[model samples]
Structure formats: C-alpha cells, structure tokens
Target: MRVPLRDTVAVAAGVLAPFVAALALLPLRTSVTHTNLALLLVVVVVAVSALGNRLAGALAALSAAAWFDFFATAPYQSFHIQDRADVETAVLLLVVGLIVSQLAAYGRTMKRVAVADATHLERLHGTTRLARAGGSSADVVRRVRQELVEVLELRSCRFEYGTLIGRPPRLDPDGSVQVEGWVWDLERQGWPEGEIELRALVHGRYQGRFLMTPAPGSVPPPLEARLVAADLAAQAAAALDEDAVSAARRS
Candidate 1:
C-alpha cells in the first residue's frame, strides 16, 4: 500500500525522537543501568503511540530497543550486548511497548466508533420525528430533504416519489450500498452528471428515490452508512407515502 507523506513523517519522528534522546543521555550511561534506559524508552514508546498510529509506535519501540542495546548495554556504543540480563531487558522493552501500542490504537478505534454510532442514532431519531410531523405534502418533502442533506452531510440532496431518474443507480438493483464514479464540474466543485440514489421500498412497493450529490471525498464509512441509509430509507418511504395520500385527498 502507498503510505501518505504525513504518516511516513510521523513514523520517522517516532523513531528519531527516542533515538536522539538516547544519544543525548549517553553521558549518564555509567550511572543508569541498561534496565533503567529500557524503562525510559518504554515512556517514549507510549508517547509515540499517542501521537501516531500503532505501526509507528512499533517502529519507535524497536528503534528505542536497538538504540538502547548500542548505547547503553555492556558492549557500549555497539549493537553487541554481552550481558544476558541486558538482553532480557531489551526483549521486555520491545514486547511491552508493542502491547502498549496495540492498546492505544484500540482505544482510538473505540472512541471513533462511539462517536459515529452516536451521530447515526441522532440522525435516525430526528428523521423519524420529521417524517411523522403533520403538514402539507410539499412542506413534508422539503423538511425531509433538508434532513437528508444534514444527516448525510452532503452538498445537496433531493427526494421524489416514483422511479429513480436519468440513469441507472450506482449500485446493482439488489444492492443497497453505493460509492462510485463521478466526473466533477469546476464551477460547482461537484459531479455535474453523476448522482447516487437510495430507494425506499415499503411492503414491496418502491416509494421513491433519495438523489444526492456528495461533497468531494465526503463518503461515509461503507458499512455504517449503508445500514443507516437502509433505515433512513424506511422513514423516507413512510413520509413520501403519506405525502402522496395527502396530495390525492386534496385534489
């Protein structure tokens, strides 16, 4: 995989930070045992993991252990470590630092998941209320359209009952998920022709389509967005169906 420049920089910084610190603290080599230096490097591993991803943290840990062996072990200033205890200490540092990095990365993942789940719940709850509101058909459609744009965080979104318009949907007929091709227009800063449509099928009756233009690179995570869209589509189906009933009764 191609690594981004920012991530490469983070990994380099993670390694270099502890390596440089080991060099500067070399003056205390006589007083600080290899064990003490290993402990100090554990702190460096944690810090690097906090700032960067797990891979960067692992690299930082290995760099710290290697540098500790060269600068702080019995055969000082060389990769060679003559003492068995020092060898064990170095191994512990590497293992412990890896564990710490994994935990840190896991924590970051959980935090992001929590935030996303909360947003999804809030969006669905608000849409339910909006769909259930009593109003003219046009006002109901307009409100739901506004909710669609806000909930999906899109540049623009619209809804209309009946079949999807213009072209075939991005997804296969049986699929509910889509993230696909777009050709941008400079003035609009978005796709001029391409759009994605999520259909609302209730009781085997296709109610309508939610047509939207995504902001550049703003697609949601694949699984979560699809599940939420499926749920949202149900609410959309109900609202559109009601709007149709109202329009018929008023005529």
Candidate 2:
C-alpha cells in the first residue's frame, strides 16, 4: 500500500528539524553555553515527538547530541568533548528526550478511541451493504472473517457461529462474562486459534467468536483490541442476521 503523504512529511520534519536548528544556532557559540545548548535539543526532541512517533524523537535526540558534541562543547569542531560535565549534559539530552517522547506517545493514545470508532464505522457500513446483497449465513460469516483479517492485518482470523470452525465452545470468560459485558480475554492469546481472541455478540447476545493471530510481535492494547474484535464480530452477526431473514423470506 502507498504510504500517506502527511506521514511522510511529518517524519521528514521530525528527522531534519534538529540538524537544522543546530546549524541555525551555530553562530551563537559565544553566547550559549554547551549545557544551555543541549537544552535546546531537548525542545527539538519534544517537537519531533509531538509531530511524529517516539522513533522520530529518538532520531532527533541522537542528531542533537552529535551536534552538541561536535560544535557546542569545548574542544569544539571535533567529535570529542573534554569536560566531564559536558559529556553528562549530552547524555542527559538523549535520556530526557527519550523519556519525554514516551510520555508524548502515551498521550497520543488518547486518540485511539476516535481512531477505533472511525475504523469500525467504516467496516460496519461496508458489511451492512454486503448483507443487503444476500448470502448464506456461512457465506456471510466467511466474508466477515476475511474482512477482519484484511482490515486488522491479523495473521489469521476464524469465526464460528454455533458450528465447528475449530474446537468446541471455548468462551475464555465469554463476551458477556465481564462486569459490563463486552468481549474480553485475559490470556492475551487470541481465542480460537490466534494469539488474540474474543467472543462475538449480536445485540449483547453471544453469537460466535473470532480467533485472530495478532501481527507477529504486535498486539493492540487489550481494551482497544477487544473493542475492535467486538466491532468485527458485530458486523459478522449482522450479516448472519440478514442472511437468515432473507432465507426465511424465500422459504
């Protein structure tokens, strides 16, 4: 898939801003102490984090540290720093930048709900249209499962609605098992056959489930992942309902 233009721009800005700032301030060598100069790099780190990911901040931090060591410290115009204090200050710039970047990353997670909602909304609309096209319950479910695998980029996705797609019913605490009753699992292993799993529900009733292998080495947060699964499962259930009603009308 083509990468978004906006993301490319954000990453570019994050990576280049530190070097640009360091060069812009090079003429101020007489006025700014090396220690004070390092602080400006920390600001660049935060700016990069705000604009992009933690990796971007780390890149900014490393770039800024190099500039600090090369131009701002005593024994200037070289890679080496003579003073112990200056070395520590340089290290602190990298450390502080990394920590702040993490904080910023966590802060950005606040948007996860909005992002999840939008994703589910789009899928729901698409599936509802597919349901209107009329397919058997099994066929609708297969399409839904395929949609889940594609949209979430899972390793695999399997769904079963009161039939054998795999083993017997393994609720793993079930969708209605929790206090507020939304699908969840504690094992972190996706339910049926994947690293992550959740029960499917239709109007708060158990209908089926999806076992999804999370992308290797990556899984969404538990709550977010569950909600995403719920949304996918709900789509499957809706499709199944549409199929059943269509069959009934024909019969």
Top-lDDT candidate index:
1
Give residue 131's error in model 1 in angstroms: 2.8
Estimate, for each residue in 76-183, the C-alpha lDDT of model 2 and write its tens digit.
878898889989988898788788877876676567657866876777676667666765567667777777676656678776457435443233332222322344
lDDT, candidate 1, 116-140, per-residue tens? 8898798788777765565544554
Assess every candidate by TM-score. Answer: 0.74, 0.53
Cα lDDT for residue 145, model 1?
Answer: 65
- TM-score of candidate 2 on Cα atoms, chains taken together: 0.53
Candidate 1 wrong stretches, greater than 4 Å: 1-12, 133-156, 160-162, 166-194, 215-222, 249-251
